[model samples]
Target: MADRRARIVLVTLSDSFSSTIEAMAQDAALAIDRWTPEGDQSWPDATAAVWLLAGGEETAALDLLAELPTNGASVFVIGSSTDHRVAAALLKGGASDYFALPGDADVVRRTLDRLVQQEGERQAADSFADAERGSVGFASVIGESAAIRRVVEQAKRVARHDNVTILIEGETGTGKEVLARAIHYHGPRAAGPFVEVNCTAIPDNLIESELFGHERGSFTGAIAAKQGLFELAHGGTLLLDEIGHLPIELQAKLLRALETREIRRVGGTKTRAVDVRVMAATHVRLAQAVARGEFREDLFYRLNVVSLRVPPLRDREGDVELLAGRFVSDLATRHGLPTPALSPEVLSALRGHPWPGNVRELRNAIERALVLSPPGTLELEQLWLERDDIPAGDRAHSLLPFPAPLENIIRAAVAAMVELTRGNKSEAARMLGISRPRLQRWLSEDTNEPTDQ
Candidate 1:
């Protein structure tokens, strides 16, 4: 019974049900094993995929069922047309399902089909509280704010329970991927591979085959069988980056895979078991998407077991100076340039500016500044920060996407002015030729951030 294949053993005299199953097995090339009931017939090694019991004699069936341990280790289906009392007894004695023969044969067939497609999930229930870590770990997540520190501590706590799914939420450049890597390397699955798939980057038509693989000749271009990112990540982690962009059609399949720990090849007839810790990272607000009818609610709850939000760079108080210094030193060293000092004025400017793109943009700014500055000196002039940093009159036209709604253009202008003035609405209004009350009205109307007021 521990044979690890989809096989059903029967203890019934229903020729119709057995014949139907036999025909299905032959057509589908499935393994159908029949074991003789022992007067000494011990409980099916009890490791079989399914046990089909028929109450030929109600008393004998009830007695046999009582003697067997029908805990959820196996699926038990009993067909009873005999005593209603006997049927009740079987169900109470751990029979998962009770159905009359032939009429309910379709249900029986469907259950077998699902079993044949995917194996039972075989996850270890033992605790992994003392999981081992890889050589490289969380040291890469550099930050001192309580915002980021709390995220790191939460990650470390869940790292020990490697099988739990995680949802990482943040703005585009807020280091969601970096946090995902930290979770994987610090857990027991450190030695296994770490695979990443950007759901947005893949074409919509090919994403299914890309995530769930395909059999040879399954489609026009599938000349050879290929394993998907999920299978490639077996025994390790699979980070579905930009997960909110995953197609709506595939959302249900994804939910089933997560729940069952199994997946089927694109054109294959059977399902296969997989052991991969899944992590979904998204910058999009999935709840809003669900409201828009673009994402599935069930799938959202499935992946939301542990949510960790990475704070935007603007929110992490003193991290800008530290991060900029580290980036400058590291980038300079990597490019073989002398390490330059960030003067007091330059540091003040760096700290005062808002980093819309978070740490990624900060790193790029430091590298650009290092490359533009003289070998041993860094000045504020050498750091452009970003093109958006230009004043309203100088870069106003460049910010608008045009063809956009008048409100949208106004919104962008207001946001740019706010960033340009470092949240100084008075100065921003003066530059934009708008009154203080008007600026407040514009900020209040911002839908994405009502709290900006």
Candidate 2:
């Protein structure tokens, strides 16, 4: 499969232009499929497509661009129009590149060659990564509950189709990325890159450049041309983690790139085409955000085309003990300690407690217990279980009036959760029952607040 010849699809209404492109493709030793506008046509198995726009055929070209199945295939448009606006419109509509008719065949050939070479390199890199990671199937997901099984089955079905956009919604630490990776490794584009970008981690000033690449000297600090996550994810999947945190301004640009299958780098005049599947994961309900005007309604519709919600830990009945046992064994092995058996009482406690932080919290708790316990059967005392076992006296003392503002108390609690989770912000946010962004804002405000003299 790696040695298979690259294929090209040529769409044209002009016989002369068709002859010219066919000649160029033939000279380049590439397989080509030629189609005309007079009939309905399906793209043959091709790595790239070239659409020739004829005079007074802008509508037809735009229609074809909209109708063409991207499926990680690059599509370019060629026309005789010198109007910069026309070219811009075509590129924004979905054309990878818009070249004037009687354009340099050498440049087209060179571009095609580059695309093929880059694909080959990508395949080689994917092969290496796959080998290192092994196979990521539905089984890798750790849960036997019906809800989880149903999600896995749906993911398997969707993985069979390569071009569908997927939106995954869940509470933090519900394994959204794990599910995304499972889909990618099992899909048609499994032999490509799987790039991930966290929306909340990047600053607003740099988000665009981080997503769409930047030209050398594009900004004050950019000294060299850099490829963005979208371009690097070419021929594979791009996981936009916490996409609900994306800024409103950048959301529009993101929608444009997803709609057009093309992106212009920061300070770049040329719009480059990218072939990548986008999978977005968010804890925030985007529909509500759309109503609130925090998220774009059009982008919401686009991303919500196919949505999957991951079930929280509490919702997966009887899975807690199973997951806890697995975590204990895995952590014990990693730490070179003997696996401890959970007492029936401990199992009961585990089953009763609601895991607000989901799998991550459970994993961390088990790891913490193992590190502190000696070689023996684990007792309830070894695990730091959150229980309602506080004595009446301690509970009464807890109500003592503290000389601190409500904001100060909240700031202290947030800091404590952060510390308890060992700097795991996502888990801290989940345990605090607040969004990560809100938690961050609270912490930021606390840091910036004036200290008492």
Candidate 3:
């Protein structure tokens, strides 16, 4: 068996500097092919390579970096200690790494090692076949409530096709990204990429290039070429999170791309065709935005091809208990300990309180509790809900006060059950041991009902 060797291209005008670089590279177990000043005449032939260029003037180093190939290869520059500026220029010029030579052997060796590892990973990623159903993997999206189950059913139905835009509407703290990943992994473009771009986090000035990509020298600071979400997510899914915050101008361009299935890089003459399913999510009400003329109506229609509303934790009946238990068990397993029990008081507190932050908040609370408390049962004190905040006794009641009697108590219980279950008369009747028609009559006769807020 032959030893696997790595190829390196060392370039420097000075022989001593070039020799030092070549020796250092060889010491790191990489084979070098030095390109002298005269041999540079055939620079075009030096195609397959990882370059190690000795530093020159900042402008010259940047020019050299720009001329290098765009494929997965790195450039390591060495020279004066002030080469930090040169390194910055190189990075802006699309160099994978920049370093001042004759410094730390261990750190330089690690940098080279990382470059080789990244190259290997990129090659492996490229070699993967772009089959729609290459693998069936699902993220941690667990829920069985009727509301959540219906949403999951809709997701499964939509995942069968590719390029169908989906709008996921949910309150903040709901796992919109988790559901998005689940859709992508199970969809026709599963083998492709699942790229996420947070529209709100990106600055207004940079949103365009971030979403659609940019060509080299596209702007003053854009010294290197950059691939945006749409290009990287080709044949896959692009999750535009917090999309409601996108500027009106960028929204117009996004709508155009959605309609045309192509995007022109920021300063490039050529338009590239892409096949990506756009799944956008927002805590804000997009319909209201359209009505207010804040969001474009055409773009709204384009993105809202299919809407899946993720139920908030408060509305997702019985899911709190299920999710809390699941989180506890998951946290226990992750910590390599026995699954702890949730006390009745803790369950009561969790169920009784309205989770304004939804499932996300719940997970955070649980994780915080687990981390703070020892491995025993998670206690009520570990959870952070103020006693006053719990909706223990504050519920809306009819204004007409009921007499403090047995009949009134029964009516209150039945009415409370009906309100708690969101006007499900049958469930109210079952809870009160009364017939459906009786409960219906009770609800219909709001005239005699007590009114108290």
Best by lDDT: 2
**Residue pair clashes in candidate 1:** 38-41, 117-271
lDDT of 1 at 450: 57
Q: Tens digit of lDDT per residue, candidate 3, span 84-144?
A: 5555566656554455555544555665564455445434554553432333233366777
Ranking by lDDT: 2, 1, 3
User: Which ten contiguous residues of candidate 3 have the minimum total lDDT?
Assistant: 129-138
Give the Cα error of residue 419 in candidate 1, in Å.
18
Please provide, for model 2 over 1-453, each residue's C-alpha lDDT reduced to its tens digit, 9 standing for 90 to 100.
444555777776445466666676677666776666566776566455454534456557867776765565656775667687876677667565666666545556666675566656666776776773454566668899999989999998999899899999999888899999999988998888989988987889999999998764479986444568998898889999999999999998999999999988886666778999999999999999999999999999999978999999999998898899888888888988888889889899889878887987788777777787777556676566753465667545434246788887788778667655656778678766578887887777765533323
In angstroms, the error of model 3 at 184 is: 0.6
- Prediction 3 global C-alpha lDDT: 0.71
Candidate 2, pairs of clashing residues: 79-101
TM-score winner between candidates 2 and 3: 2
Off by over 4 Å in 1: 1-136, 386-394, 401-453
Clashes of each: 2, 1, 9
Highest TM-score model number: 2
Model 2 spans > 4 angstroms off: 1-128, 132-135, 387-412, 418-453
**What shift in Å separates residue 67 of candidate 3 from its native position after superposition?**
22
Question: Model 2 — TM-score against the truth?
Answer: 0.66
